[model samples]
Target: MSSPNGASEKQSEQSEAISSRKWFARGARAAISIPAFILTAAFVGYAGLARETGLTLLETLAMTGFIWALPSVVVLTGALSSGMGIVPAGIAVALASVRLMPMTMALMPIIKVQGKTKNWQLLIASHFVAVTAWVYAMKHLPELPREARLPFFVGFGSSISTFVFVLTGIAYLLVERLPDVVAGALFLLTPVYFLCSLWGAARLNADKAAMVAGLVLGPVFFISLPGLDLLWTGLMGGTLAYLATRIWRRGLS
Candidate 1:
Protein backbone atom coordinates (compact mmCIF):
# COMPACT_ATOMS: atom_id res chain seq x y z
CA MET A 1 0.00 0.00 0.00
CA SER A 2 1.13 3.58 -0.63
CA SER A 3 2.38 5.54 2.35
CA PRO A 4 0.03 8.24 3.67
CA ASN A 5 2.43 10.97 2.56
CA GLY A 6 2.60 9.50 -0.93
CA ALA A 7 -1.20 9.40 -1.09
CA SER A 8 -1.39 13.03 -0.01
CA GLU A 9 1.13 14.06 -2.64
CA LYS A 10 -0.79 12.18 -5.32
CA GLN A 11 -4.00 13.90 -4.31
CA SER A 12 -2.36 17.31 -4.44
CA GLU A 13 -1.03 16.65 -7.91
CA GLN A 14 -4.43 15.54 -9.12
CA SER A 15 -6.04 18.58 -7.59
CA GLU A 16 -3.60 20.88 -9.31
CA ALA A 17 -4.27 19.24 -12.66
CA ILE A 18 -7.99 19.55 -12.14
CA SER A 19 -7.67 23.21 -11.23
CA SER A 20 -5.62 23.93 -14.35
CA ARG A 21 -8.27 22.32 -16.54
CA LYS A 22 -10.99 24.27 -14.78
CA TRP A 23 -9.16 27.55 -15.33
CA PHE A 24 -8.84 26.78 -19.02
CA ALA A 25 -12.50 25.92 -19.21
CA ARG A 26 -13.46 29.08 -17.34
CA GLY A 27 -11.35 31.16 -19.71
CA ALA A 28 -13.30 29.75 -22.62
CA ARG A 29 -16.69 30.16 -20.99
CA ALA A 30 -15.96 33.71 -19.88
CA ALA A 31 -15.20 34.55 -23.47
CA ILE A 32 -18.80 33.57 -24.35
CA SER A 33 -21.18 34.03 -21.44
CA ILE A 34 -23.88 36.40 -20.19
CA PRO A 35 -21.17 38.17 -18.23
CA ALA A 36 -19.29 38.71 -21.46
CA PHE A 37 -22.47 40.02 -23.05
CA ILE A 38 -23.04 42.41 -20.18
CA LEU A 39 -19.47 43.68 -20.44
CA THR A 40 -19.89 44.09 -24.18
CA ALA A 41 -23.09 46.03 -23.62
CA ALA A 42 -21.23 48.41 -21.33
CA PHE A 43 -18.63 49.07 -24.02
CA VAL A 44 -21.35 49.50 -26.61
CA GLY A 45 -23.00 52.07 -24.41
CA TYR A 46 -19.71 53.94 -24.25
CA ALA A 47 -19.51 54.09 -28.03
CA GLY A 48 -23.11 55.20 -28.36
CA LEU A 49 -22.68 57.82 -25.69
CA ALA A 50 -19.63 59.16 -27.47
CA ARG A 51 -21.50 59.45 -30.75
CA GLU A 52 -24.51 61.13 -29.14
CA THR A 53 -22.24 63.52 -27.30
CA GLY A 54 -20.53 64.52 -30.61
CA LEU A 55 -17.26 62.56 -30.38
CA THR A 56 -16.09 60.93 -33.61
CA LEU A 57 -16.53 57.21 -34.21
CA LEU A 58 -12.79 56.79 -34.71
CA GLU A 59 -12.11 58.43 -31.37
CA THR A 60 -14.70 56.22 -29.71
CA LEU A 61 -13.24 53.04 -31.16
CA ALA A 62 -9.72 54.18 -30.38
CA MET A 63 -10.60 54.69 -26.74
CA THR A 64 -12.22 51.27 -26.56
CA GLY A 65 -9.31 49.57 -28.30
CA PHE A 66 -6.49 51.34 -26.48
CA ILE A 67 -7.81 52.48 -23.12
CA TRP A 68 -10.04 49.41 -22.67
CA ALA A 69 -11.44 51.05 -19.56
CA LEU A 70 -15.06 52.12 -19.21
CA PRO A 71 -14.77 54.74 -16.48
CA SER A 72 -12.00 56.55 -18.36
CA VAL A 73 -14.05 56.51 -21.52
CA VAL A 74 -17.02 57.94 -19.65
CA VAL A 75 -14.89 60.68 -18.12
CA LEU A 76 -13.45 61.55 -21.51
CA THR A 77 -16.89 61.73 -23.07
CA GLY A 78 -18.31 63.84 -20.27
CA ALA A 79 -15.33 66.17 -20.37
CA LEU A 80 -15.64 66.69 -24.11
CA SER A 81 -19.35 67.38 -23.78
CA SER A 82 -18.61 70.01 -21.15
CA GLY A 83 -16.19 71.76 -23.59
CA MET A 84 -13.16 70.70 -21.58
CA GLY A 85 -9.76 70.87 -23.26
CA ILE A 86 -8.25 67.70 -24.67
CA VAL A 87 -5.39 67.88 -22.16
CA PRO A 88 -7.72 67.94 -19.15
CA ALA A 89 -9.85 65.15 -20.63
CA GLY A 90 -6.76 63.07 -21.14
CA ILE A 91 -5.61 63.75 -17.57
CA ALA A 92 -8.94 62.63 -16.14
CA VAL A 93 -8.84 59.46 -18.19
CA ALA A 94 -5.33 58.66 -17.02
CA LEU A 95 -6.29 59.25 -13.43
CA ALA A 96 -9.18 56.82 -13.76
CA SER A 97 -6.83 54.21 -15.24
CA VAL A 98 -4.43 54.44 -12.30
CA ARG A 99 -6.55 51.83 -10.53
CA LEU A 100 -5.20 49.27 -12.96
CA MET A 101 -1.62 49.72 -11.74
CA PRO A 102 -2.21 47.86 -8.50
CA MET A 103 -4.23 45.23 -10.31
CA THR A 104 -1.42 44.64 -12.80
CA MET A 105 1.15 44.39 -10.03
CA ALA A 106 -0.84 41.71 -8.24
CA LEU A 107 -1.43 39.75 -11.47
CA MET A 108 2.04 39.87 -13.06
CA PRO A 109 3.69 37.56 -10.52
CA ILE A 110 1.01 34.94 -10.96
CA ILE A 111 0.97 34.99 -14.78
CA LYS A 112 4.59 35.72 -15.53
CA VAL A 113 5.33 34.18 -18.93
CA GLN A 114 8.92 34.45 -20.24
CA GLY A 115 10.73 35.04 -23.58
CA LYS A 116 9.28 35.87 -27.02
CA THR A 117 6.05 34.27 -25.86
CA LYS A 118 5.77 36.77 -23.07
CA ASN A 119 6.23 39.62 -25.55
CA TRP A 120 3.39 38.34 -27.70
CA GLN A 121 1.23 37.78 -24.65
CA LEU A 122 1.79 41.35 -23.50
CA LEU A 123 0.88 42.72 -26.92
CA ILE A 124 -2.41 40.84 -26.96
CA ALA A 125 -3.07 41.56 -23.29
CA SER A 126 -2.83 45.35 -23.75
CA HIS A 127 -5.88 45.37 -26.01
CA PHE A 128 -7.87 43.08 -23.71
CA VAL A 129 -6.97 44.55 -20.35
CA ALA A 130 -10.38 45.66 -19.06
CA VAL A 131 -12.01 45.38 -15.63
CA THR A 132 -13.77 42.05 -16.20
CA ALA A 133 -10.74 40.25 -17.54
CA TRP A 134 -8.58 41.66 -14.75
CA VAL A 135 -11.01 40.48 -12.07
CA TYR A 136 -11.35 37.02 -13.65
CA ALA A 137 -7.60 36.56 -14.00
CA MET A 138 -6.85 37.68 -10.45
CA LYS A 139 -9.33 35.16 -9.08
CA HIS A 140 -8.48 32.17 -11.29
CA LEU A 141 -4.89 32.44 -12.57
CA PRO A 142 -3.19 31.66 -9.25
CA GLU A 143 -4.29 28.04 -9.52
CA LEU A 144 -2.93 27.77 -13.06
CA PRO A 145 0.60 26.78 -14.02
CA ARG A 146 2.87 29.49 -15.40
CA GLU A 147 2.82 27.85 -18.79
CA ALA A 148 -0.97 27.73 -18.94
CA ARG A 149 -1.56 31.17 -17.52
CA LEU A 150 -0.79 33.10 -20.73
CA PRO A 151 -3.10 31.03 -22.90
CA PHE A 152 -5.91 31.24 -20.36
CA PHE A 153 -5.61 35.01 -20.08
CA VAL A 154 -5.30 35.45 -23.82
CA GLY A 155 -8.40 33.38 -24.36
CA PHE A 156 -10.32 35.31 -21.74
CA GLY A 157 -9.17 38.70 -22.96
CA SER A 158 -9.67 37.94 -26.63
CA SER A 159 -13.20 36.82 -25.93
CA ILE A 160 -14.05 40.07 -24.21
CA SER A 161 -12.50 42.17 -26.97
CA THR A 162 -14.40 40.32 -29.65
CA PHE A 163 -17.68 40.76 -27.84
CA VAL A 164 -16.99 44.40 -27.17
CA PHE A 165 -16.34 45.06 -30.83
CA VAL A 166 -19.67 43.61 -31.80
CA LEU A 167 -21.53 45.34 -29.03
CA THR A 168 -19.97 48.70 -29.80
CA GLY A 169 -21.24 48.48 -33.33
CA ILE A 170 -24.70 47.59 -32.09
CA ALA A 171 -24.78 50.47 -29.66
CA TYR A 172 -23.62 52.94 -32.27
CA LEU A 173 -26.37 51.85 -34.60
CA LEU A 174 -29.12 51.76 -31.94
CA VAL A 175 -28.21 54.88 -30.00
CA GLU A 176 -31.37 56.69 -31.04
CA ARG A 177 -33.82 53.97 -30.08
CA LEU A 178 -32.33 53.18 -26.66
CA PRO A 179 -34.04 55.08 -23.88
CA ASP A 180 -31.99 57.15 -21.41
CA VAL A 181 -33.42 55.21 -18.49
CA VAL A 182 -32.25 51.93 -19.96
CA ALA A 183 -28.84 53.33 -20.84
CA GLY A 184 -28.38 54.68 -17.32
CA ALA A 185 -29.34 51.31 -15.85
CA LEU A 186 -26.92 49.50 -18.11
CA PHE A 187 -24.14 51.90 -17.11
CA LEU A 188 -24.60 51.04 -13.45
CA LEU A 189 -23.66 47.40 -14.13
CA THR A 190 -19.99 48.20 -14.67
CA PRO A 191 -19.31 49.49 -11.15
CA VAL A 192 -21.72 47.04 -9.55
CA TYR A 193 -20.05 44.10 -11.22
CA PHE A 194 -16.55 45.24 -10.28
CA LEU A 195 -17.40 45.96 -6.64
CA CYS A 196 -19.26 42.66 -6.19
CA SER A 197 -16.49 40.68 -7.85
CA LEU A 198 -13.84 42.42 -5.79
CA TRP A 199 -15.76 41.65 -2.64
CA GLY A 200 -16.17 38.02 -3.64
CA ALA A 201 -12.44 37.71 -4.41
CA ALA A 202 -11.54 38.75 -0.87
CA ARG A 203 -10.92 35.25 0.38
CA LEU A 204 -7.56 35.87 2.00
CA ASN A 205 -7.23 37.75 5.30
CA ALA A 206 -5.33 40.62 3.70
CA ASP A 207 -7.88 40.93 0.90
CA LYS A 208 -10.77 40.92 3.36
CA ALA A 209 -9.11 43.58 5.46
CA ALA A 210 -8.32 45.77 2.45
CA MET A 211 -11.87 45.43 1.12
CA VAL A 212 -13.47 46.24 4.43
CA ALA A 213 -11.21 49.20 4.91
CA GLY A 214 -11.89 50.50 1.41
CA LEU A 215 -15.63 50.11 1.79
CA VAL A 216 -15.66 51.98 5.07
CA LEU A 217 -13.28 54.71 3.99
CA GLY A 218 -14.39 55.29 0.37
CA PRO A 219 -17.69 57.04 1.10
CA VAL A 220 -16.35 59.00 4.04
CA PHE A 221 -13.47 60.28 1.99
CA PHE A 222 -15.79 61.07 -0.92
CA ILE A 223 -18.00 63.17 1.32
CA SER A 224 -15.05 65.17 2.64
CA LEU A 225 -13.03 65.50 -0.57
CA PRO A 226 -14.90 65.32 -3.85
CA GLY A 227 -12.26 65.33 -6.58
CA LEU A 228 -9.38 63.41 -4.97
CA ASP A 229 -11.53 61.00 -3.02
CA LEU A 230 -10.77 57.75 -4.78
CA LEU A 231 -7.04 58.26 -4.73
CA TRP A 232 -6.83 59.23 -1.08
CA THR A 233 -9.34 56.63 0.04
CA GLY A 234 -7.47 53.82 -1.68
CA LEU A 235 -4.15 54.91 -0.25
CA MET A 236 -5.37 55.33 3.30
CA GLY A 237 -7.57 52.24 3.34
CA GLY A 238 -5.00 49.96 1.72
CA THR A 239 -2.19 51.24 3.94
CA LEU A 240 -4.16 50.83 7.11
CA ALA A 241 -5.27 47.34 6.11
CA TYR A 242 -1.71 46.31 5.35
CA LEU A 243 -0.41 47.65 8.66
CA ALA A 244 -3.18 45.99 10.61
CA THR A 245 -2.54 42.64 8.96
CA ARG A 246 1.19 42.89 9.62
CA ILE A 247 0.63 43.61 13.29
CA TRP A 248 -1.80 40.71 13.62
CA ARG A 249 0.60 38.30 11.95
CA ARG A 250 3.54 39.48 14.09
CA GLY A 251 1.58 38.89 17.23
CA LEU A 252 0.65 35.39 16.14
CA SER A 253 4.23 34.55 15.25
Candidate 2:
Protein backbone atom coordinates (compact mmCIF):
# COMPACT_ATOMS: atom_id res chain seq x y z
CA MET A 1 0.00 0.00 0.00
CA SER A 2 1.18 3.59 -0.64
CA SER A 3 2.22 5.78 2.25
CA PRO A 4 -0.44 8.21 3.46
CA ASN A 5 1.64 11.36 2.63
CA GLY A 6 2.50 9.98 -0.80
CA ALA A 7 -1.14 9.47 -1.58
CA SER A 8 -1.99 12.95 -0.24
CA GLU A 9 0.68 14.58 -2.43
CA LYS A 10 -0.63 12.78 -5.49
CA GLN A 11 -4.14 13.83 -4.61
CA SER A 12 -3.06 17.44 -4.32
CA GLU A 13 -1.34 17.31 -7.69
CA GLN A 14 -4.42 15.84 -9.31
CA SER A 15 -6.63 18.49 -7.74
CA GLU A 16 -4.36 21.24 -9.03
CA ALA A 17 -4.38 19.75 -12.50
CA ILE A 18 -8.16 19.53 -12.50
CA SER A 19 -8.42 23.12 -11.31
CA SER A 20 -6.02 24.22 -14.03
CA ARG A 21 -8.18 22.54 -16.63
CA LYS A 22 -11.28 24.33 -15.38
CA TRP A 23 -9.50 27.66 -15.61
CA PHE A 24 -8.16 26.85 -19.03
CA ALA A 25 -11.65 26.01 -20.20
CA ARG A 26 -12.90 29.23 -18.64
CA GLY A 27 -10.26 31.15 -20.56
CA ALA A 28 -11.38 29.53 -23.81
CA ARG A 29 -14.95 30.61 -23.09
CA ALA A 30 -13.79 34.10 -22.23
CA ALA A 31 -11.77 34.27 -25.43
CA ILE A 32 -14.87 33.35 -27.39
CA SER A 33 -17.06 35.77 -25.45
CA ILE A 34 -14.60 38.63 -25.80
CA PRO A 35 -14.70 38.00 -29.54
CA ALA A 36 -10.92 38.18 -29.95
CA PHE A 37 -11.40 38.14 -33.74
CA ILE A 38 -12.22 41.84 -33.77
CA LEU A 39 -8.76 42.71 -32.55
CA THR A 40 -7.10 40.43 -35.10
CA ALA A 41 -8.65 42.63 -37.78
CA ALA A 42 -5.46 44.60 -37.36
CA PHE A 43 -3.59 41.67 -38.83
CA VAL A 44 -5.77 42.08 -41.92
CA GLY A 45 -4.32 45.57 -42.25
CA TYR A 46 -0.92 44.04 -41.55
CA ALA A 47 -1.39 41.60 -44.42
CA GLY A 48 -2.33 44.45 -46.72
CA LEU A 49 0.59 46.51 -45.44
CA ALA A 50 2.99 43.65 -46.01
CA ARG A 51 1.73 43.11 -49.58
CA GLU A 52 1.94 46.82 -50.35
CA THR A 53 5.52 46.73 -49.15
CA GLY A 54 6.25 43.94 -51.67
CA LEU A 55 5.98 40.85 -49.50
CA THR A 56 4.18 37.89 -51.09
CA LEU A 57 1.18 36.36 -49.33
CA LEU A 58 3.25 33.44 -48.09
CA GLU A 59 6.02 35.67 -46.75
CA THR A 60 3.45 37.88 -45.04
CA LEU A 61 1.74 34.88 -43.51
CA ALA A 62 5.08 33.65 -42.21
CA MET A 63 5.65 37.06 -40.62
CA THR A 64 2.27 36.90 -38.90
CA GLY A 65 3.35 33.64 -37.26
CA PHE A 66 7.00 34.44 -36.55
CA ILE A 67 7.09 38.15 -35.80
CA TRP A 68 3.67 37.88 -34.07
CA ALA A 69 3.35 41.56 -33.32
CA LEU A 70 1.53 43.87 -35.75
CA PRO A 71 3.62 47.03 -35.22
CA SER A 72 6.86 45.07 -35.46
CA VAL A 73 5.68 43.25 -38.58
CA VAL A 74 4.68 46.52 -40.22
CA VAL A 75 7.92 48.29 -39.31
CA LEU A 76 10.25 45.47 -40.32
CA THR A 77 8.40 44.67 -43.56
CA GLY A 78 8.27 48.31 -44.61
CA ALA A 79 11.99 48.72 -44.01
CA LEU A 80 13.04 45.52 -45.76
CA SER A 81 11.06 46.34 -48.92
CA SER A 82 12.52 49.85 -48.96
CA GLY A 83 15.98 48.25 -49.36
CA MET A 84 17.12 48.84 -45.80
CA GLY A 85 19.55 46.06 -44.91
CA ILE A 86 18.84 43.49 -42.23
CA VAL A 87 20.80 45.30 -39.47
CA PRO A 88 18.96 48.62 -39.80
CA ALA A 89 15.63 46.90 -40.32
CA GLY A 90 16.15 44.82 -37.20
CA ILE A 91 16.97 47.94 -35.18
CA ALA A 92 13.81 49.68 -36.37
CA VAL A 93 11.69 46.68 -35.49
CA ALA A 94 13.26 46.48 -32.02
CA LEU A 95 12.61 50.17 -31.42
CA ALA A 96 8.95 49.74 -32.35
CA SER A 97 8.62 46.97 -29.77
CA VAL A 98 9.98 49.06 -26.88
CA ARG A 99 6.45 49.42 -25.56
CA LEU A 100 6.16 45.67 -25.21
CA MET A 101 8.95 45.66 -22.63
CA PRO A 102 6.79 47.07 -19.86
CA MET A 103 3.79 45.06 -20.94
CA THR A 104 5.74 41.80 -20.73
CA MET A 105 7.14 42.75 -17.38
CA ALA A 106 3.66 43.27 -15.99
CA LEU A 107 2.26 40.16 -17.62
CA MET A 108 4.97 37.62 -16.82
CA PRO A 109 4.29 37.62 -13.12
CA ILE A 110 0.60 37.03 -13.65
CA ILE A 111 0.97 34.29 -16.25
CA LYS A 112 4.11 32.49 -15.16
CA VAL A 113 3.59 28.73 -14.66
CA GLN A 114 6.22 27.87 -12.10
CA GLY A 115 7.44 24.24 -11.87
CA LYS A 116 5.42 23.34 -14.95
CA THR A 117 6.93 25.27 -17.88
CA LYS A 118 10.38 25.00 -19.33
CA ASN A 119 12.36 28.17 -20.00
CA TRP A 120 11.87 27.84 -23.74
CA GLN A 121 8.14 27.53 -23.20
CA LEU A 122 8.13 30.74 -21.16
CA LEU A 123 10.06 32.50 -23.91
CA ILE A 124 7.60 31.28 -26.55
CA ALA A 125 4.66 32.35 -24.38
CA SER A 126 6.24 35.78 -23.99
CA HIS A 127 6.13 36.26 -27.76
CA PHE A 128 2.37 36.09 -27.54
CA VAL A 129 2.38 39.01 -25.10
CA ALA A 130 0.87 41.64 -27.41
CA VAL A 131 -1.65 44.38 -26.62
CA THR A 132 -4.84 42.37 -27.10
CA ALA A 133 -3.75 39.31 -25.12
CA TRP A 134 -2.14 41.45 -22.43
CA VAL A 135 -5.29 43.47 -21.97
CA TYR A 136 -7.53 40.43 -21.90
CA ALA A 137 -5.22 38.55 -19.53
CA MET A 138 -4.84 41.49 -17.21
CA LYS A 139 -8.58 41.90 -17.01
CA HIS A 140 -9.39 38.22 -16.51
CA LEU A 141 -6.41 36.43 -14.95
CA PRO A 142 -7.00 37.88 -11.53
CA GLU A 143 -10.28 36.06 -11.29
CA LEU A 144 -8.53 32.69 -11.76
CA PRO A 145 -6.38 30.54 -9.49
CA ARG A 146 -2.61 30.82 -9.60
CA GLU A 147 -2.25 27.34 -11.06
CA ALA A 148 -4.59 28.22 -13.93
CA ARG A 149 -3.45 31.67 -15.05
CA LEU A 150 -0.65 30.45 -17.25
CA PRO A 151 -2.67 27.67 -18.83
CA PHE A 152 -5.58 30.03 -19.42
CA PHE A 153 -3.34 32.61 -21.04
CA VAL A 154 -1.57 30.00 -23.12
CA GLY A 155 -4.90 28.65 -24.35
CA PHE A 156 -6.34 32.10 -24.96
CA GLY A 157 -3.23 33.37 -26.71
CA SER A 158 -2.80 30.22 -28.78
CA SER A 159 -6.38 30.51 -30.00
CA ILE A 160 -6.06 34.13 -31.10
CA SER A 161 -2.52 33.83 -32.45
CA THR A 162 -3.51 30.94 -34.68
CA PHE A 163 -6.54 32.87 -35.92
CA VAL A 164 -4.40 35.91 -36.71
CA PHE A 165 -1.82 33.89 -38.61
CA VAL A 166 -4.50 32.21 -40.72
CA LEU A 167 -6.42 35.39 -41.47
CA THR A 168 -3.35 37.36 -42.46
CA GLY A 169 -2.92 34.99 -45.43
CA ILE A 170 -6.58 35.28 -46.26
CA ALA A 171 -6.48 39.07 -46.10
CA TYR A 172 -3.49 39.26 -48.41
CA LEU A 173 -5.32 37.08 -50.91
CA LEU A 174 -8.57 39.06 -50.57
CA VAL A 175 -7.23 42.63 -50.44
CA GLU A 176 -6.83 42.74 -54.20
CA ARG A 177 -10.43 41.66 -54.62
CA LEU A 178 -11.91 44.36 -52.33
CA PRO A 179 -12.76 47.90 -53.36
CA ASP A 180 -10.01 50.46 -52.77
CA VAL A 181 -12.12 52.43 -50.30
CA VAL A 182 -12.99 49.33 -48.32
CA ALA A 183 -9.35 48.31 -48.26
CA GLY A 184 -8.32 51.70 -46.92
CA ALA A 185 -10.97 51.59 -44.21
CA LEU A 186 -9.85 48.14 -43.10
CA PHE A 187 -6.24 49.31 -42.89
CA LEU A 188 -7.14 52.18 -40.54
CA LEU A 189 -9.18 50.07 -38.13
CA THR A 190 -6.16 48.56 -36.33
CA PRO A 191 -4.44 51.85 -35.56
CA VAL A 192 -7.69 53.40 -34.41
CA TYR A 193 -8.27 50.53 -32.01
CA PHE A 194 -4.64 50.69 -30.87
CA LEU A 195 -4.95 54.35 -29.92
CA CYS A 196 -8.19 53.74 -28.05
CA SER A 197 -6.72 50.80 -26.14
CA LEU A 198 -3.66 52.84 -25.19
CA TRP A 199 -5.81 55.63 -23.78
CA GLY A 200 -8.10 53.30 -21.90
CA ALA A 201 -5.26 51.35 -20.28
CA ALA A 202 -2.94 54.23 -19.47
CA ARG A 203 -2.74 54.69 -15.71
CA LEU A 204 0.32 56.82 -15.25
CA ASN A 205 0.89 60.52 -15.89
CA ALA A 206 3.97 59.55 -17.93
CA ASP A 207 1.85 57.45 -20.28
CA LYS A 208 -0.49 60.34 -21.01
CA ALA A 209 2.51 62.61 -21.46
CA ALA A 210 4.09 60.20 -23.95
CA MET A 211 0.90 60.11 -25.96
CA VAL A 212 0.72 63.90 -26.02
CA ALA A 213 4.34 64.19 -27.09
CA GLY A 214 4.00 61.49 -29.75
CA LEU A 215 1.02 63.23 -31.31
CA VAL A 216 2.63 66.67 -31.14
CA LEU A 217 6.10 65.68 -32.32
CA GLY A 218 5.41 62.77 -34.66
CA PRO A 219 4.30 64.92 -37.60
CA VAL A 220 6.85 67.61 -36.84
CA PHE A 221 9.68 65.07 -36.75
CA PHE A 222 8.38 63.33 -39.88
CA ILE A 223 8.48 66.60 -41.83
CA SER A 224 11.93 67.45 -40.53
CA LEU A 225 13.68 64.08 -40.49
CA PRO A 226 12.10 62.18 -43.39
CA GLY A 227 12.99 58.46 -43.24
CA LEU A 228 14.26 58.40 -39.64
CA ASP A 229 11.18 60.17 -38.21
CA LEU A 230 9.53 57.33 -36.28
CA LEU A 231 12.72 56.41 -34.48
CA TRP A 232 13.54 60.01 -33.58
CA THR A 233 9.95 60.76 -32.64
CA GLY A 234 9.88 57.90 -30.17
CA LEU A 235 13.30 58.66 -28.66
CA MET A 236 12.88 62.42 -28.27
CA GLY A 237 9.18 62.42 -27.49
CA GLY A 238 9.20 59.49 -25.07
CA THR A 239 12.30 60.82 -23.31
CA LEU A 240 10.85 64.31 -22.91
CA ALA A 241 7.61 62.90 -21.61
CA TYR A 242 9.39 60.73 -19.08
CA LEU A 243 11.49 63.66 -17.91
CA ALA A 244 8.47 65.93 -17.64
CA THR A 245 6.47 63.48 -15.60
CA ARG A 246 9.38 62.69 -13.27
CA ILE A 247 9.96 66.36 -12.63
CA TRP A 248 6.27 67.05 -12.06
CA ARG A 249 5.94 64.15 -9.64
CA ARG A 250 9.06 65.14 -7.72
CA GLY A 251 7.88 68.77 -7.44
CA LEU A 252 4.52 67.66 -6.06
CA SER A 253 6.18 65.34 -3.55
- Best TM-score among the predictions, by candidate number: 1
Query: Relative to the true structure, how large is the alpha-carbon lDDT of every model?
Result: 0.75, 0.77
Give the best candidate by lDDT.
2
lDDT of 1: 0.75
Task: Assess the local accuracy of residue 183 in candidate 1 as a C-alpha lDDT between 0 and 100.
Answer: 78
Off by over 4 Å in 1: 1-29, 114-120, 123-127
Q: Residues 1-253, candidate 2, lDDT per residue (tens digit)?
A: 4776998888998998788677767766667643376666667766766776778877887778887777788887878788999888888888777767777887877777677766776787788788788877766677777777887887788778877787778788877655677668877776676677667666688988988898899899889986667778777988999999998889745
- Worst lDDT run of 10 residues, candidate 2, spans 33-42
N/CA/C clash count, model 2: 0
Q: Which tens-of-lDDT digit does each residue in 12-106 have in candidate 1?
A: 88987687567666677767866687787777667767887887767777767767778877887798789888787877777777777777777
Candidate 2, overall lDDT? 0.77
Query: After TM-score superposition, what is the CA distance of residue 212 in candidate 1 from its true location, in Å?
Result: 2.2
- Superposed by TM-score, candidate 2 places the C-alpha of residue 30 at a distance from the truth, in angstroms, of 2.2
Decoy 2 TM-score against native: 0.77
